[model samples]
Target chain A: MSAIYKRELNAYFTSPIAYVVYAVASFFAGLLFVATVLEGDTSDMTYLFRNMTTIIIMMIPILTMKLFSEEKNKKTEQGLLTAPVNLLQIVMGKISAAVTVYALLMVLFIIYALIISFFVTPSWVLIGSNILGLLLFGTTLIAIDTFISSLTESQVIAAILSIGAGLLLTSISMFKNMVDIDFVNDIIDSIEMMGRYENFTLGMVKFSDVIFFLSISVLFIFFTIKVLERRRWN
Target chain B: MIEVKNLVKKYGDKVAVNNVSFTVNEGEILGFLGPNGAGKSTTMNIITGYLSSTSGTVTIDGCEILDDPKGAKSKIGYLPEIPPLYQDMTVKRYLEFVYDLKRVTLPRKEHLAEVCKVTKITDVYGRVIKNLSKGYRQRVGFAQALIGNPPVIILDEPTVGLDPKQIIEMRNLIRGLGKKHTVILSSHVLSEIQAVCDRIVVINNGQLVADESTEEITTNFTGMKRIQLHIDGNDNTVLMTLRDVDGVTRVRKVMRTIDGFTEYIVESKAENDVRKAIFRAMAKVDCPIVMMRNAEVSLEDAFLRITAGETQVNRKGGR
Candidate 1:
């Protein structure tokens, strides 16, 4: 598992994808920071963290689209699957590598808060909670996108499908409002990812929300392993 | 050692491999001979635990592939049809990654260097795989399979895209590997298998057609031996003399050369060597034989005959 993890991490840096992801992420995060912190003259990072979720939704597919799809395309998955490693190890190694990259991006946000600290003292607890929330959210997105990547051999299709899934998960609240039935609204409210994330933006670390994100990540990672296993029989 | 029993793999309603079974003893080079789309790769994949057999059992070094995949896979190193290489990595990093992936206990630098020397890719060790030529890339793939020094090495069409020189080099490399590791190599080229394998398992349309020693398949599968002769004599006397020779089934004039030599093709029973008798008869009749050579029955002929339902006869007659 460590072997695969190290190789995957090196692959990200060797290619141009990691830099492109960072550049795109920094562009959006910088834009939001300038608008929310400088023009509004506020030390509060709630608005910036909240808006970064949308940027993450758009940028994470780029980091994960080639996770499994490129392996299948180049026929390298045969090597990985035939190696002396279990399916869980392969999945975990890949997801951890992508998460590490996403975590590095989150560190960029910490730097933004540090820059704001010079003017007015910012709450470290709030920043820590927001970073933790973003990390969990980004990991869940990576797991989901990696599963989508495993289902297809083309990276473009994987990226498109992942972006579609991310947008749908973020917009579940809108669907809940559009429906009038109480039972259907309750179901949507329970599954809405963006709503659970709002508590973290306000510096609240809800345990249930944490469990929800972790469960979703585990479910998708399990599905990805199943898809890979089923492919061998096919 | 590897044992495959009643292996059957089906993709939907189409059967890719049907009740195929064979074994490779230690230190033997077993060649899987088949044409395209003949499930050669599928069988290799199943043996290496990359793909599952719908109904079968593959045991490698006492470990069943399905029941104990890690144990089975740990003893086998596989090189698929296309060399699975990470294009973004340099050769050194890629090999180090494979070493770690295989969990080899040997000293990393020495093992990798030895593999590179054997595959003759040490000079290109610093370059990225994407920039290497097809031959160099294939050698790197071969190097990857040798990292752990597994007991069994399975290669599917390892020399598919190489040039003539590289093919010979690859054949020599495989022969060297067979000294220590039991090797299973698959190829459609008859000469490649004939040159490298200790035994050949001919597969046609996903069925095991013939499994015999290299000499047995070449000698017994032909059924009839043909000898081409060029003689400088009267055509009538040459034909009459050759006809009286024992075990000579048929004799006919093929062509007349510009130098007054007549060419004749003589067919005989497979077990007989009628060359001496023909020479004596020709000498007695004063028909000087200019040249004589046996016309070998190629692998294509034997393959076609076996695939055309002569397997039962060949199998019974061969051993």
Candidate 2:
């Protein structure tokens, strides 16, 4: 597992995906922060993470796009598949690596907070709650990207499809108001990623919201592992 | 050391490995022979627990691959056809990573040193794999397969793209490994297997066509006893005389004007060797035989028969 982790982490940076992901997300994040909160008079850290959730949705695919897809495309997955390690170890190692990169991106949000503190007092409870929300949101996005990566061998397709799917899930809340059916509205709102995240970003930090995000993340990761497991027989 | 039973792999209606079964004894060097897409690599993959067999089982040292993959895989070291390298990594880093993946129990540094010493990659360890030649890349692949000193080594076309010198070196390395490890080397190149393997298993269309000791299989598959004749008489007379010999099945008089003597390639009937009768007959015809030899059946001839002359397509292209 450690071997896979180290190799995958190094590959992310070596192949330039990690740097590209960090630069693209952080640059747009920087711009969003400056335009919305940094340049504005009032500062809401939760407001900043809420806005950056879009950036996370867009950029998570780059971090996880090649997790399994590129390996299979390049035929190097044979090396990992034939290794002494089991499939769970391989999937978990890659997921952990993607989470690590995602965590690094969230750390950039801290820099945004520090700059905000220069103008206004930084609220500890507000910042703590926002960071927790950011972690849950980032983890779920990474898990979605991981599942997308397992679905295709072409990394580009994986990235595009994941971004498209994530956009749908993120805007599921908006679609609920647009649709007239009551049952559909309730189902859509319950499954809406941002709907569950709205409470956390609003500093409520409900246990149910945390559990929803955690469960979705595990469900997607479990699905990705199953996709990989199916290859042995196929 | 390894047992594969009724193994079958089907791709829709096309069977890749169809009910193939074989066993390798401990410390035996087995060779897998087959033409392109004949399921040699697929069999190797199933044995190494890389791919699951559709409807059968493989037990490596008593641990079934499906039941205990880690235990079974720990016993077998595999090198696929393409070497499965991370082109970005240097040889040392790549091998160290493999060492970790194999979970070598010895101290990490010591185990690495042992692998380097055995594979002779210590000097070139710092070179990036992409920068290295194909031969070096192959060696790096072999080094990884040898990392944990597994009892069984499964190499698929190990010497595929190597030069003559590297080919000899790899063969010698595998031969040396046969002293301690049960090695299964698969190749379409019969000479490669003939040089290294103790036993040979010929597979075609996913079926085990033949399995025997290397010499036994080659000799059995050759089917003809060849007699070379250096006759001083006319080629036509020698040809007719060979036909008159009771056991001679067929004769091809080789066209060689070497020092004004003739050579004949007289193939005997499957179970007959009429060398003594031919010698006596040649003496009677006053065509004194200068030299004679029974052409031993080569591994190449055996492989040609195994692939059913499909390899003759190469000759057609050459022509």
Candidate 3:
């Protein structure tokens, strides 16, 4: 797992995608921060968190586009699979590597908060909560992207599907109108990733929301491994 | 070192490998020969634990791959048909990643050094694999399989896309690996199999129909032996006269324009030697038999007969 993690993290920086992801996400997040904090007379950072989610969606695809898709395409999957490690170790290693990059981006965002603390005033509690939310939210996105990347051999297809899946999951709150159907509305709100994110950004630690995000991430990671395992037989 | 039993891999309704079973002893080189999509890749994939079998069991070095995958997989090293490689990584870096993933003992710098020496790619190790020639990339791939010092190595078409010189080099490298590990080299190339393997496993239409020593498969699969006869006579009458010989299964004209005479090719039953009879028969026909030679079965003929019969006969473990 450590080996795979190092390899993936190195790949992120070796290519231009890592810098591009950070530049694009941090740019818009900074703008949203100024508008929500100054013009709107609010430091709630709900808007900041919302923008961070969007950044993650677009950037995570670029981050994970090469994970398994490129391996399969380049025929490097044989090298990895034939190696002595188990499937779980390999999958976890790749995820950890992507998460490391995501963590680096989060650290950059935290630095932005530190700058805000010096210039105006930083809500450390809210900032702390947001970081936690970012980790949870980032992992969820990475899990989805990783799974999508594993499903195809084409990087373009994997990237597009990951972006689309991220959008779909984040937009689950749109189905709240189905409150007319009590059960359906309950399920959507429970699975609603953005709805769950609101609590983390607001500095309220909700156990159910935390568990839901992690659960979703774990579920997809397991699915990705299963998809990979099935490939051996066919 | 490897055992496969009743292995059947199906993609939906289409079977890729059907009821394939074979064994490889320690330090033996087993060759898998088949046509394209002949399940050569699928079988290798299953044996290496890359893909789960639809219905089968694979045991490597006494450990079942499915029951204890990590244990079984650790003993096996597979080079897939395409030499799956990460192009962006340097050859050495890629091998390093393979070593890491293979979980070799750390701090054993000597093991790593020895593998590079064996593959003879130390000079090219520092360069990105994307920039290396296909031959070098293949050697680097072989180097990856050699990591962890696994006891079993399975190489699928290891020399598929190489120049003639590189192909020979790759064969020598594989043969060297065979001395230390149980190696399975899968290819449709007949000479590669005949040259490198101790035993041959021939599969056709996803079935293991022939698994025997190379010579045994050659002798049994090609049911008839071939002979070349140079007859001092006109083409038509010599052909007619040889066709009537008792032990001949087939008679064909190998050449008629060599020196203004016909050269007949006679295929006799596998167990029968009709050379002396044809010699005397030609003498009596007043058509002098200048020279007669029997042609042993080649790997090409063995592969064709085995694969062709695998589709047609559906034989049940006929020894």
Q: Pick the candidate with the highest TM-score.
A: 1
Chain A alone, TM-score for each of the models?
A: 0.97, 0.92, 0.93
> Which clashing pairs does model 2 show?
none
Better of 1 and 2 by DockQ: 1
Candidate 3's residue-wise lDDT over B150-254, tens digit each?
Answer: 899989899989999999988898888888999999999878898889888888889877777876665564777899878898777787878888898778786
Residues B81-107, candidate 2, lDDT per residue (tens digit)?
988888888888788888888888878
How far residue B58's Cα lies from its native spot in candidate 2, in Å, is: 0.8
Better of 1 and 3 by lDDT: 1
Model 1, DockQ value? Answer: 0.69
Please, what are the lDDT tens digits per residue for candidate 1 over residues A155-189? Answer: 99999999999999998788776868999998888
Per-residue error for A231 in candidate 1, Å, reads 0.6
Q: Indicate the DockQ of the complex predicted as candidate 3.
A: 0.61
Q: Give the range where candidate 3 chain B is weakest over 10 consecutive residues by summed lDDT.
A: B310-319
DockQ of each: 0.69, 0.62, 0.61
List lDDT for all candidates, in order: 0.91, 0.84, 0.83
Q: Name the docking class for model 1.
A: medium
